[model samples]
Target: MPLMHQLWLLVPWAVFALAAGVKFWRLTRPFRRQLAEPSTEQVRASLERRWRADQRELTE
Candidate 1:
């Protein structure tokens, strides 16, 4: 509840959000544009899913 404690909590949370945002930024843009229609949607979805899954596997 103190100002210092609030600052400490907010600092790390802001850092984490910024980091995650930077990482995922523009990740799905190309895919989304190319796959907005029906046929390519499944393929794009698979690619996107695999990408995130691979990142998780690597991190783990």
Candidate 2:
């Protein structure tokens, strides 16, 4: 086979990978923004709230 044929086979795979990466980045972009610089107090409060909610659900 020629070099061009080998290179052409990789084009579809490259396109698929690029599309997947963009989709994943867009989907998680907001979450990443919020977590990029979270404060310790904020993190603790969020975790505590979630834990309390879980405990309540378990008791029900």
Candidate number achieving the greatest lDDT relative to the actual structure: 2
Candidate 2 regions exceeding 4 Å error are 38-60
lDDT of 1 by residue, 1-60 (tens): 899887898888899999889777678678878767667788799899999999999999
Model 2 C-alpha lDDT per residue in residues 1-60, reported as the tens digit of each score = 999999999999999999999999999999999779789998899999999999999999
How accurate locally is residue 57 in candidate 2, as Cα lDDT from 0 to 100?
A: 100
The local distance difference test score of each candidate is 0.86, 0.97
Q: Candidate 2 clash total?
A: 0
List the candidates' TM-scores in order.
0.40, 0.58
Model 2 Cα displacement at 26 (Å)?
A: 0.4
Query: For candidate 1, what is the total of clashing residue pairs?
Result: 0
